[model samples]
Target: MRVLVTGGAGFIGSNFALRARERRPEWQLTVIDAMTYAANRASLEPVLTTGEVALVEGNIADAALVDGLVADHDVVVHFAAESHNDNSLDSPWPFVESNVVGTFTLLEAIRRHGKRLHHISTDEVYGDLELDDPARFTEQTPVNPSSPYSATKASADLLVRAWIRSFGIEATVSNCSNNYGPRQHVEKFIPRQITGILQGVRPKLYGSGLNVRDWIHVDDHNDAVIAILEQGRLGETYLIGADGERNNLEIVRMLLELMGKPADWFDHVDDRPGHDLRYAIDSTKLRRETDWQPRYGDLHAGLAQTIDWYRTNESWWREAKVAAERTYERLGR
Candidate 1:
C-alpha cells in the first residue's frame, strides 16, 4: 500500500508517519509539506532513515503538485494547514487559503486521481460548547465554528463532504481534540509556557484561563489516524481523542509544577475575541470499531513527558521560534 501524507513534518503528522510505517512495513510513504514554521525538518529527520519515506516541499494548495502526488497513492491523509487561533486572529486570509482552499485542492486532486482520502479535522470546527456536557462530540454534531482557524477547518470539512457526494471521491474526516507532545511549535500553549518559564518571562493567560480543551498525545493521535486510514468507513467521519480534558489554568499549573515555576508568575491578559469556552470529542466509534487505544492515557505523565521533550530539545525549539517570527512579521497585524 502506498500512501501520501500532507503536512507530514508537523507535530502530529510526523508522529503519524513514523507510527504508520511501523504498522505497515510494506507500505511506501510520501510526505508533502510546505515546511511552515510549525513544521520542522528536524522532527521528520528520524522518519527519513528508511528509503520508503520521501519528503516533498510544496504547498498543498498547489493543484498541480497535489494532483501528481495523489494520482498514484492509494491513500491521502490531508493534514496540511495554517493552524493557530492567535495567528488566525491576526490574519485569517492565510488560514482560509491553507485550511479551506488547500483542502479543496486536495479533494479535487483525489477526485482527479480516484484515490481515497482521510481529511484530518479538529474539535474546534464544532465550535464552543454552548452547553457544557461530558459526552463526546458525535459525527452528527452541527458545525458552528467560532474562531477563524476553526471556521476554515469547518469549511474544509464541508468541502470533503461535497467531494464525496458530488464527485464520488472515497474519503472520511476525523475531528480530533487538542494535541500536545514533542515537536509542537513553541508558539502553542504548552511549549509557550515552558519557553516563557525558561526565559524568565511571565506566561500570559487569557481571561481566567478556564477555557477547556480535550488533550490527546501526539503518539496516541497517530495511532487513531492510522486506525482510521486502515479501517475507517467511507463517507463517514470519526472523532479521535484520549478523552483527556483540561482547562487553560489547570494546564498552566501543571506546566509550572513540572518546571518548578510559580502560578503567581502568570501575566493576566485580556481574553482574545471569541475564545471558545470548552472543546471535547466523543470517540466511542473509534474505540469500538477499530483496534485503537491511546498509550498516553495518563494526562499527568503525558504532560511531564512533553515537558521533558521540550527541556531536552531546547535548540530544536530555538530554531523553530526564529522561523515562526518570519510568518508573524508577514501577517503584520
Candidate 2:
C-alpha cells in the first residue's frame, strides 16, 4: 500500500511516520512537509535513509502539488497545520492559509481521486471545560474554539464533515488531546520545560500555572489514528486520549523534582490572552470501537523518557531552542 503523510517532519507526524514504517515495512510511505520553523527534517532521517520513506518539501496549500500527491497514494494522513497557539496569536493569517485553505485543497484532491483520508485534529476545537466541570469533550461535543489555531481546525473539521455527507468522501477525523513525547517542538509545554532545565534556564509558567490539559503520549495518539484508518467506519469522528489529566503546576513541579531541582525553581509570567481554563477528552468511543489502548498511560514515566530524548539528542533541538527562546524572551512570555 502507498501512503501520503502530510506534515511528516513535524513532531506528531514524524512519530507517526516512524511507527508506521516499523509496523508496516511493506508499505510505501511518502511524507510531504512544509518544513516550517517547528519542523525538523532530522526526525525522519532513520526511515528516509533506509529508503522506506520519501520526503517532499512543499506547502499543502499548493493545490496542484496536493492533487498529484493524493492521486498516487491510496491513503492520505492529513497532519499538516499551523498548530502553535502562541504563533497563531502573533500571526493568524498563516493559520487560516495552512489549516483552512490547506485542508480544503487536500479534501478536494481526495474527493477527486476517491482516496481514503484520516484527518488529525485537536481537542481544543471543543474549546475548554471549566475547571470544576465534571464533563469531558467527546465526539458529540460542540465546537467552540477559542484560539485562531483551533478556529481554523474547527473549520477544517466542518469541511470534512460536509464533504463526507454531501459528496460521499471516505474519511475519518480524530481529535486528540495535548500530546507529549519525543520529537515535540521545544515551543510546546513539556519540551520547553524539559529543554529549559537541560540548558540551566529556569522554566517559565504562565499565569497561576493551574490551567489543566488532558495529555496523551504521541505513540498512543498515533496508534489510535492507525486504528481509525484500518477499522473506523466512514464519516465517523473519534476522540483520542489517555486518561492523563494534569494541571500546569503539577507538571512543572514534577519536572523539577525529576531533574533534581526545587518545585519553586520556575518563573511565572503573564498569561496569554483568552487562555482556556482546562481541556479534557472522552475517548470511550475510540477505545470501545477499536482494540486500541495506550501503553504509556503514566505521565511521569512518559515524561522521563521524553526528557531523556531531549538530553541525549541535543544537536537535534539545540538550534530550535535558541530561536524559540529568543522569540519567547521578546514576547516576555
Candidate 3:
C-alpha cells in the first residue's frame, strides 16, 4: 500500500508514520509536511535514513501539489492543520488557510482520484462542556467551536461530510481528545510544562487551572486512526479517547510531584481568550466497532515516559523551546 501522510513531520503525524512503517514494512510511505515551526524533521530521521519513508516539504493548501500526491497514494491520512489554540487566537488566518482551504483542496483531490481519506480532527470542534455535565462528547455531538483553531477544524469536518454525501467521496473522520506523547511541539501544553521544568523554569498555568481535558496518548490516537482507515464505514465519524480526563491543575500538580518539585511550584498566568472550560470524549463507538485499545492507559506513566523522551532527546526540541518561550514571554503567558 502507498500511503500519503500530511503533516508527517509534526508530533502525532510523525508517530503515526513511525508506527505505520513498523507495522507494515512492505508498504511505501510518503510524508508531506510544511516544515512549520512545530514540525521537527529530526523526528522522521530514522525512517528517512532507512529509505522506508519519503519526506516532501510543502503546503497542503497548494492545490497542484496536493492533487499530485493524492493521485499517487492509495490512502491519504490528512493531519495537516494550524492546531495551536493560542497561536490561532493570535492569528486566525493561517488556521483558515490550512484547516479549511487545505481540507477543501484534499477533498477535491480525493474526489477526482477516488482514493481513500481519513481526516484527523479534534474534540475541541464540539466545544466545551460544563464541568458538571455528566455527558461526554460522542460522535453525535454537534459542533460548537469556541476558538478559531476549532472553528476551522469544524469547518473542515463539515466540508468533508458535504463531500461524502454530495460527491460520494470515500472518507472517514475521527475527532480525538487531547494527545500527549513524544515528538510533540514545545508550544503545546504538556511539552511546554515538561520542558520548562527541565530547564529549571517554573511551569505556568492559565486561569484557575481547573479546565478539564480528556487526554490520550499520541500512539493510541494514531492506532485508532489506522483502525478507522482500515475498518470504519464510509461517511461515519468516530471519537477517539482513552478515558483519561484530568483538569489542568491536577496535571500540573502531578508533573511537579514527578519532577521532584512541590505541588505549588508553578505560576498562574492570564488565560487566553475564549478558553473552553472542559472537554471529554466518549469513544464507545470506536472501541465497539474496531478491535482497538489504548496501551498507555496510565496518565502518570505516559507523562513520565514523555518527560524521559524530552530529557534524552534534547537536541530535537531545544531550539524550538527557546523560540516558543520567547513568544510566550512576549505574550506574558
lDDT ranking of the models: 2, 3, 1
TM-score of each: 0.93, 0.99, 0.99
lDDT per residue as tens, model 3, 1-333: 899999999999999999998777777899999998988889999999989899999999999999999999999999999999988988899999999999999999999999999999999999999999999999889999998999999999999999999999989999999999999999999999999999999989999999999999998998898889778988999999999999999999988988999999999999888999999999999989998899998999999999899989999989999899899888778
Residue-pair clashes, model 2: 0
Predicted candidate 2 versus true structure: per-residue lDDT over 1-333, tens digit per residue: 899999999999999999998777777999999998989999999988988899999999999999999999999999999999999898899999999999999999999999999999999999999999999998999999999999999999999999999999999999999999999999999999999999898888999999999999999999888899888988999999999999999999989998999989999999999899999999999989999999998888998988889999999989999999898888779
- Stretches of candidate 2 above 4 Å error? none
lDDT of 1 at 330: 65
* Structure candidate 1, residue pairs in collision: 136-282, 137-282
State which candidate has the highest lDDT: 2
lDDT of each: 0.85, 0.94, 0.93
- Which ranges in model 3 have alpha carbons more than 4 Å from their true place? none
Stronger candidate by lDDT (1 vs 2)? 2
**Backbone steric clashes in candidate 3, count:** 0
